[model samples]
Target: MYDFNSINDYLNTKIIGQTIIQYDNLTSTYAKDKNIFNTCPDGTVVLSENQSKCTVRFGNKWICREDKNIYLSIILKPIGKNLMISKFDVIGCSSVCEAVADTCNVECKIKWPNDVMINNNKISSVSCDFVGKSDDPSGVIISMVVNANMGTDEIDKINEEIKNSSTSLKIETGTDVHRELIIGHILNNVEKHYDEFMKQGTIISAVSSCIHNSAIVNKTISVMKRGKKTVRKLYAKSIDGEGRLVVADEKENEEILSPGETIIIYEGKA
Candidate 1:
């Protein structure tokens, strides 16, 4: 488990992760009710060494390994009307990607709907949703779980159970990194894009950053329509302004699929 003082000392963000809260174990980081949320200021980060509960974006069990991974949530209060949770999905990926690169010297890919992968094996999973009552001091919680330092056997087991194949910082780099440092880097990267979103009030830049680090973009990959196992081969052109995936075929005919309706798989070559 990472120390509170270490994470706090390492973080230097403006509006994200300004307050670091850690627990020895919890059901979930963002599991608090409306009353607790009302008291917590915006940018409060919640973390745990062992999570006994909760699911990711697709309702898949986020397998928590004791002291082997990083699972945390950053709270942002007073979400604006009609906020697109999709934008935050990619922004979370961007933050995780940048953090992985910063701490582990590893490049990552974005599997649609918030699975960050390295070599087609998942390194992180993200989720965002409005917490607290709509009428109260509610806000969006962007939660992520990074496979920071899990061992190979534990990583392998979760991979068989989860949709994406799994890998960890320890597995990929053959090294165990200080999880606290990675958390700090992720907070900083998140704040960078959060500032842009607040200032520009747009998803273009957020989508662009995710696209740059995209695993499926500009690649010939397998596309499985969400809710069914049926998969297709398509050329991923890019993610559009609305964060929808733009995929094309041999003759350049294109189909834009919403994140909820599409699942992408990266087959090694073509």
Candidate 2:
């Protein structure tokens, strides 16, 4: 049994958690956070023990069991000079990767736009949604789902099909992990990285961080864009300033792809 109150109380004392709301159970923290985005504070964090209908980057269901994962959404009001959604995505994904590595001793990489991977298997997913425009916005709600503390048998029992493509901290480290600790680490890292982003006042720093820690950069990959018929196989060159995937084909023809679906073709390839 996890101590929700203790963790929530401790988290509220942190920088990113001015006001924290912890639901021992919920249908979807992301949906709920979006619903009350206007009323929440600038750095309000909504956490749940169980999310029955959690969603990831492509609106795919994030299979989460009761009291077994880190499911939360943070509502942030961008107060910086130039705040783009793409920059925020980079910050969020990088934050998760740093936090996971710091806590689990596993070096994870960003799989562009949002997914965090360890050994080519997804260990966490981050999704950012902005209600209004870049000039004038209500708030940016970032929903993150980190598969923490889930055992191999637990993951296999929940979604056997995706077990091969997905992984958790416990599965990688071969020990039970504390979800509360991981959440704390993530929130702290988000705040730290966000401050760095604010100081630079550009997405260049964010993009640089992603490129350095990316798992898909300089690798052969197949990209599947939304509503596109054909899949393109190209070498992932790097992440552009705007967070787009810059890829080139054999002919050396290059294309900058906006945030979409990308699959790494080879393992351990730079």
Candidate 3:
């Protein structure tokens, strides 16, 4: 079993309230238990080994790579009543990518809603589901998976594919890194940002700084809308309070976009 010590150690270092769980695996028999396990306040994290099986039925993909990844879920009871659960996924992705870059000195990018890419290749994917909502405004549950287990050969192939698209820490610095430490660093950074966001309102200026530092701001890209036929190219101006991308066309007209909108942000003309 993977050690929960790292998570425990992190929680000890921070003022945030959290809970940690380490399990071998679980079945549907304990689904309720799993849900209850995450019902804590913000910063509560559930870490398990070979836990629940990933299935397409849940709109989740089981990305199996050796053992160089951290599969963990964080339960957060956000402070405000107006907090949008949808924004957490995007925020989590952006924060995680930034955390990885800052810790490893590698460049990373977010693929739309919740995927992280290193050197144009997929390194991590994040998915979330709302179990329930409280009338008094509780919090949200964010399940995140960070792939830190890619082998050198896998990294090489990923680098080749993303040479023109993305980058990874190992590829950039040519050094092997500890996946656990990376995961811990990411969690710590995320906690810091989450706290800041709770203190400050989610305005474009306040949040854009973090997003901009991650190289994800003001890029021209194409976004495909859900249940629609047309894909439009626009400059991703900023992300709004609702977590929608505020995109602009050639005429600088703006539009708000939700998930299922495929976006391609690169060095090409949009």
Candidate number with greatest lDDT: 1
Clashes of each: 0, 0, 6
The TM-score of candidate 3 is: 0.75
TM-score of each: 0.86, 0.87, 0.75
Which candidate's TM-score is highest? 2
Model 2 Cα shift for residue 43 (angstroms) = 1.5
Better of 2 and 3 by TM-score: 2
Relative to the true structure, how large is the alpha-carbon lDDT of every model? 0.78, 0.77, 0.57
What candidate 3 gets wrong by more than 4 Å, as runs, is: 10-17, 26-34, 37-39, 55-62, 133-138, 152-176, 201-206, 213-216, 260-270
lDDT of 2 by residue, 48-144 (tens): 8898788887677777877778888888776645656666788788878888888789889898888888888888888988866746777688889
TM-score of 2: 0.87
Residue pairs clashing, model 3: 68-148, 68-149, 77-139, 119-166, 119-167, 120-166
Ranking by TM-score: 2, 1, 3
lDDT minimum window of 10 residues, candidate 1: 155-164
